[model samples]
Structures are given as structure tokens and as C-alpha cells.
Target: MTAPTREPANPRFHKEIVSFTRRGGRLTERQQDAWDDLASTYVLDIPRHTSSTSVDPEFQLDLTETFGREASTIMEIGSGRGEALVHAAHENPDINFLGLEVYIPGVAQALVTMRHLGVTNIRFAIVDAAAALATMLPAASLDELRIWFPDPWHKKRHHKRRLITDDFVPLAARVVKPNGVWRLATDWQEYADQMHEVLLSATGFEYSGVWDERFDDRPITRFEGKGIAAGREIRDLSARRINP
Candidate 1:
């Protein structure tokens, strides 16, 4: 396999977070324990960014534990900065939200927002959404999955890294129950077309009606703000998992 080419775009448009495994990574035992304790104690289910095996087994929830709950569960993959998660959690207190974003700084910022707002219904993990569906979630467990404004990777060589590809959609279908919603938003036109094609081609899923600002009044994300500043058009695609 060839190496994925790195594109230097507007720094603000992309995440500034570094991975936890990077060299010179330092976290005090208390901080680590806090992360673990919060993960374990939070009754509302949240995904974990790290491998659960290294942690105490009591904190972990298996398929039965995850699926046994009757609450409407929503997992927003690529939940950068978690603004949507916090907003959704605040607006709809009845639904349980699980957000997964791979950036530590973003997670910290989101946590601060959650604390300031006193939003208790949402939980977070820092993990790649593409990889998490197969491993972390059980079949037909989720009610809705959101992937909004993911990295377009506009360069031709980096297209494979786009989250809406063939490989990831089926895994999404597997995790979401029948008729569950998969909401995707993108500012890049080509990437939006790619998302449409790939999602429509994927079995067990069907593309629903297209939406605009009038239809869904979602807050403008940081990345989308940049796109708007550059006079880019934002497109949203809503698809449903028809077959479990």
C-alpha cells in the first residue's frame, strides 16, 4: 500500500489535535483515572476511544449490556468539537447520544462545553468512526448515526480516506436498526457526489430526501463556516438503513 499524501490546507479547517500515542505523550495518573472513572460511571452509554481491554473489565459493556437498554441511542461519528452533540442533547433530553471524535483537543473543548451547559445526556470517545462500527457496536443497536462535514480530503490520492466510502457504509448499516437514519453533510461538491453514489450503491441502505437550511436548521460548524467564507455550497444527504 502507498502512503496517504498529507495536504496542508487551512489549519483551522482541519483539527489541531494530536494523537494520544504520540511521542512525549504525557498524562498524569489522576487524569488517566478520571478518564477511566468517567467512562465507567457514566450511566448513559458512551463509546471509548482507547482499547477497553487495558482497562478494568467492570467498566466495559458487552453486546447484551449495550443493546439491552431501551433508550433511543444515537452515535454521531466524527463528532468534531461536539457542538451538534451538545446542542442535540440539550434540545432533546429524551435521547441518549454517543459521540466519537479522534481528536483530544476537540474532545476537551467539547467536554468544557458540556460542563458549562450542564448537558448530561451525551457521552464521548476519541476513536475513528470507520473502525469503531465493526468493533464497538453490535448489530442493529443504534437508532441514528450522524457524520457531518467530514474531511473532504480534496486531493485525488486521499479520496480513500473519506468516511462515506463503500467499506464504511455497510458497517454503518450493520450497526443501525432498520429505518435508522444516517445523516451526512459535506461542503465539497465532488465529495458530496461521491457520498451520494457510494451510499446509494451500498446494500441495506436507501437514500432519503435531500435537505437544505430551510429543512434542517443546524448550526454552522467550524469547518462549514470556513467553507461558507470561501463561497462554497453545503449539501446534506439523509439515508436510512432499510435492512438490518
Candidate 2:
């Protein structure tokens, strides 16, 4: 459960460790079309602090007002391409879903999926997940938090950039309600070990002792496909926040 002491040099204004890199790439035809037509509807217009992906700490995100209801809420961290989020939103229309993704193309693609499937219960934000967890969201707001197929940061030196860490565990616990579940999936053994090692002793959460089964509803993404193609075992883990 050792936390890495490494952090990026001079992050302009904040000292918080960032997880994902901002990838700049031209969108595909479908992604561009979806972005043009549906972004205003599905993407949030939240205030930013430092960078475009940075969240404004003082900006309050009222889930009830945004989703137009106060039903059970699920926030998916790093919701790449939105297959699972869209599927769950379509399957259970009563629940409100907010997907946190930094990549534009993935978020655009997610909008494409939602549009094509005619799903309306999901919304997205292009904010840093750490900042969202640390500041923007209300405490005990989410019923479930899902982190699927996060980049494992396989290199020993780059492990500090991995999303699940000692510092991140509390930020996650801060947002999830008491008894709320945090579900995570990965295709790297060492990273999976690191996740369990960190969460096992985390202050506000309790880890399930053994590895959990695959989340059947989650559709295989391109990342997961590559992992499977490389013969890596996909591991799913779950933890529950202790009631305050």
C-alpha cells in the first residue's frame, strides 16, 4: 500500500496528480457528426479551473438538476466510449448516469452510441476524475462508482500515473455514499495487485477479499479487446464504502 511520491512538475495551478493524458486527434465522421449534433445536449458545460479538463473546485454540480431527477446515481470514471454507461442507462432508465472522460473522441463516440441507441438518461463531463471526486461533486451523492479498464501504467516508473492509489482511494470514498460500491476492472496482474493493496486498508472503504467476476453488462471495448488478444486476464474488483 505504498503511495508513489512522484508528481508531474508544475501543473500550472494545482498540485493534484492527474491520471489521463489529454489526447488530441481528429474525430472520425461518426464522432464528428455526433459531436456537432449531440454534444450540447449530453456534454456538461461545467466551469474549469486550470486546463480544459480541470474542474472548478467551487463549481457545484447538482446531479438532480442536471439529470432532471433525484433517482439512484452512478458515476463512471474514465468511461471510455460509453458502451457500459449507455447500455446500463438504456437498460435501467430510472437511474441517472454521469460519465467522466477527458478524451474528446471517446466522449463523442459515446454520444454516438447514446444517440444511435436512443438513450437519454446519460450525461457526460470532460473533467478530470480526480478533481470531480475531490471538489465538484457533492459528498455521498453516488450510489455506485465504476472504473472499467483504466490504463494500468505497466512500466514501473510510470506507476505513479495509475489512477488507483493511496491518495485516490479517499477521493473516491469522498464522493460515494456510505455503503456505495466501487467497481473496477483491469487486464494487468500487477496493477490489479496494486489496486487491492491500496484499497484493502483504505480508511472509508472495505475491499472484497477475492477477485470478483466479470461485469456481464459491460461491453468489450477496444482496449479490453487488445488485452484479450494479448492473452491478459481481465480482473474485476469491488469495494464498499463504510457507512459514516
Candidate 3:
């Protein structure tokens, strides 16, 4: 699980790592239309707010101090609707969370949810999680990371669009601290198998277990509910970083 001694030097490393083939992808015409329209609705400048020196007044305590153990920062990839981030932040008040999602409405919805729930420990950005991970997250800064119910892109020709792949896992491994956990869930059994293979082959991860039963802290996501209703089997994979 040793970290890669060097990162790719190309300016496109971020883009290359996560970019997917758009042609023949799983998105329907309607979904594409909605995504285009919704993506444009984003009004906030994410890079501005996240980089600003002014901290949000809602944060009740500095993360290091409140956690007592001094290390409890977590970032969730593809945080849709913000339900999981909001719930996790509310339940574990000591941890600080940053959620990344690309959809405009989803970002706004998550912000509103954070405000309504009166939780101060979470922040969000509208961006592709993989690009953000490479450039935004500090190396070795995350304790836990989750990618739940990401787009399955079920068609064989569209498999390249799926996020969990050999190219991106090394970047995740870089950001996660030693012994940190990474969780991924998907109801698509074929895609789940693909993830298992890709992650197990990645350089910096140690696949701990694959579970048929939900672990204690893994919440049944709204997506998981829809999956269950459709009689799809929920698949979960747990892995840890074995080197700093």
C-alpha cells in the first residue's frame, strides 16, 4: 500500500484520470437534457467560497480540537442530495466533512438541508469528485471516504464511464491516511464485480471484505431503497489504506 513515489506530470492528469467516454453512455436523452439544464443552474462560484479565508459561522468547533483525537476530516465523493453527508455529520458531530457533487440543484439542495438540520460541520462543492480529489484535497488528509450508488453505466460499451477504475484508485489512496477506510456501494451486480477487480488491483489499497449484510455504520441510502424496490442486490466493498 505504499504511495506512488511520484504523480503524473501532465496537466491533464486530473481530467485523464476521471474522464469517461460520453458516446453510448447509459444516460438517457431525458437524463442528459435534465443534467444539462440543471448543471447550468449552479450560480455559486465553488472555488471562490472554498478557497476564501473566511470560515462559515456555522462551524461550532475547530475539527482537530472537537474530535479530541485530532484527526477526523472526511470527504464524500458524489454526494447527491446531501442526505448521507447531512446525516453522517449530524450523527457524528466531531468530524468535518466536505461533499463533492456536480449537479447544481443537488448542491443547492444539500446546502439547504445542512442549514435546516442545523449542522455546522459540513461544506460542499459542485465539481467532479475525481478532479477535485487530485487538486483540492490535501495529501493524506482524509480519514474516511465513501462513494455510494454512483452511476452504474450498465452497458458493456459504456463501462469506461464508471468511476471506480484503475486510473483513479491511486489518487484516492494518496489522499487517505494510513489505515483509513474507503467504502463503495452499488446495486448493479456486474458493476460491483468490476469495482472489486479494479480496487483489488490498485496499488495502495488492501481490500478488507465484501459484505452481503450491511455493516453497523453504513446507512441504507435512498438510492439503495430504490434498488431494493427493484429487487436488485445491494453490494458493498470495504478497503483500507495500508501505507501512509
RMSD of each: 8.2, 5.7, 10.2
**Per-residue lDDT tens digits of candidate 2, residues 3-120?**
1122244567345556766666678998888888888778998887877777778898999899887899999999888878998899989999999988777888988889899999
TM-score of 1: 0.74
Per-residue lDDT of candidate 3, residues 45-96 (tens digit): 3332231211233232233533335548888887777778888888888887
The C-alpha TM-scores of every prediction are 0.74, 0.92, 0.72
Pairs of colliding residues, candidate 3 = none
* Candidate 1 deviant stretches above 4 angstroms: 1-69, 209-217
Best by lDDT: 2
The clash numbers for all candidates, in the given order, read 0, 0, 0
lDDT of each: 0.64, 0.85, 0.65
Clashes of 2: 0
Which candidate order results from sorting by TM-score in descending order?
A: 2, 1, 3
- Pairs of residues at least 3 apart in sequence or in different chains that clash in candidate 1: none
Q: Pick the candidate with the highest TM-score.
A: 2
